[model samples]
Target: MADSIFKRYLEKKNNLIKNRGILQATYVPDVLLHRDYQIEEIVDIVAPSLNKDKPSNIIIIGQTGTGKTAVVNYVGHELERADAENKNCRYIYVNCEVIDTPYSILYNISNQIITDPNKKIPFTGWSLEKIFNELANYIDDENKIFIVVLDEIDMSFKKNGDDIFYYLTTINEMLKNSRVSIIGITNNSTFAEKFLSPRIRSRLGEEKIVFPPYTPEQLIDILKNRAEQAFYPNVLDNSVIPYCAAISAQGSGDARKALDLLRISADIAERNGDSIVTSAHVDYARQKIELDAVVEVIKTLTDQSKIVLMSIIKTPSSNDTGSVTTGEVYTTYVELSKNLGYNPLSQRMVANLISEMDMLGIITARVKSFGRGGRTKEIDVNKVSNDVFSILSSDDIFRGMNLNQKLKKQTTLM
Candidate 1:
């Protein structure tokens, strides 16, 4: 029976191919044509001080998907290969988003320096000062030049302030000859400047690299470069690559988003049993990405935001009305707060909460031009009712809520 089926299948003209999207990272070429300006700046910083024993630090500011992380990784790999000849030089990278807080971040660096796995530091329950002192000693003992890359430093600072900055910068002053350098990556340039004290800001001011968003044409080149390796011959529609590039370029010239769009469009094509990805597949993929982003935003929201959203969901005309006024949303918010047995705050506070929700893409607000006589803003429920309901029901905090009943009411209200 297997032989007969194999024979029948072989008789059919087949064009199935392994997807190129699976090899995403490999497909990303090492060339930095569009990012040459940034590469040149970073190289200058590293080159001048490579032979010197004094510690150096660099602060890199770039929006997401402008190849900040990629360029750093690429340069890091090259540095690693060069340093293999001399064991005294070392490079390590940590995404502060993953190792958030001063203690955790310091502990990670300490672990890299000290080879003892059994003496690993705990995530919490230790003072930041103790961790820093211990980590500084560990680095000193290594007697090697260390380069540390801290990606998403903004998130780290937001969680734990400038304490880590103080530790890293001050450690170099205390050490005798052991060199330490930090490559700090952040999406917000103003965040560090505004929050950090002048002392720490001046230390970080030595090397500043700002990366602007990519233009549509530049992004097209990036997409085309990756497409040649990711897909089989003629497997993608001619328009799909440019469409994905244009969409991503508009957002921030984010290469990651562009790559993701291409990957997702190919998956969509395969799901529909199509031989190649078309414009329709790319459009569908965009909708899917939007929904996924919204879902992820919903998942990370605080309990208070969920309560406010649930209140919006309870309203009968929210979907049709586009947005409920701030006052109306406040009323519903109070009702839900009561039902959940939590004390409700004032409308001003609720408005702030609504703004946070809007930032998270849970909802959108429209500012009405009310001829100097009306409210400045109105709240809009931008997401689909079902999507919001699905996300809320998945949360551990909202686990026991009546999802079906609430969603039923919302659907009826539609």
Candidate 2:
């Protein structure tokens, strides 16, 4: 019998990662770095529950990887540990991004609180009001303080509306023997002011906590702490962690991104049979992660947004700098929309879409002044690679149109 094809690869010893799970974003450390004040504040807020009292509803706002969710999870874990004997406090974490919608959110909360199989809420076929009543009754029956952490709470608001939030906030009023406290976690700090009604906002924002972005120094400390447990001794070069932290800090100061960079860099080194992870590996990992992110963002864009993007892509540069004016993009968009039998958005609306894409880093739209003639944006698609074009082209609307032919016609007209 022939030796297995994987025999040689299997024989290669794993020397780089001591425990890869330690580098994951979901892995909460025993002690979170650079978030001492936030942790203490959360502890103080929830400590009332230990005495069988309800804590105020909390809204934790911050950018991605700023330790908002981590701090909440850490505090929840510690709270549950402290209440193990009396069982007066219960912690439930629900990621709203996954379990979005009014009915699903209520159902998820109900299922968590109602653990008995015979009394478990059905996954579907129940009205939102019914689910809320069941969830409230179960909590009141337990006579315990329930802390429900709604991570990415903004997603639920965007999908269904603020009704679920209103329900949760008013749930305590329905219970006689127990209380429910909400902890909403969101990346959008303005979510409450923009999307929520005044009543919901005032109730949910009783104790709002804003988490600031981590600086490069803070990111370095975070990465180093995780690195000690994630990698073997001498596996990572002296510069690997610093480089990862600096790159992530330069963008959003995300500790998760830094840890991801470190993990992917080590993976690349290990795959190449290298003993030590270096700054070069970190560079490769950054590029790979960025490309993957761009592809995903483009994939999730609405069809209209994709058409607007394609118009920008097909627009001819007005000068030798390889950038097109917003006017030029609008003209191309109007013609393309007409030919495709789709209603063309107004130039102002198209400009707003362009600005949105600019915010996403899909294109560079810089305002160029024209003296007294008013200013227009000079849009650059330098970051939109062929991979992006392919992703957009796979859509049904784009499948029928020849992008190259459209570009040629636009160029000839220019």
Quick one: best lDDT, which candidate? 2
Question: Which residue segments of model 1 deviate by more than 4 Å?
Answer: 1-29, 49-55, 116-134, 300-356, 367-386, 389-414
Q: Which candidate's TM-score is highest? A: 2
User: 171 in model 2: Cα distance from truth in Å?
Assistant: 2.2
Cα lDDT tens digits, model 2, 100-171, are 888888888888777789988888898888888888888899999999999998898888888888899999
lDDT against the true structure, per candidate, is 0.75, 0.87
Clashing pairs in 2: none
CA displacement after TM-score superposition, residue 141 of candidate 2 (Å):
1.4
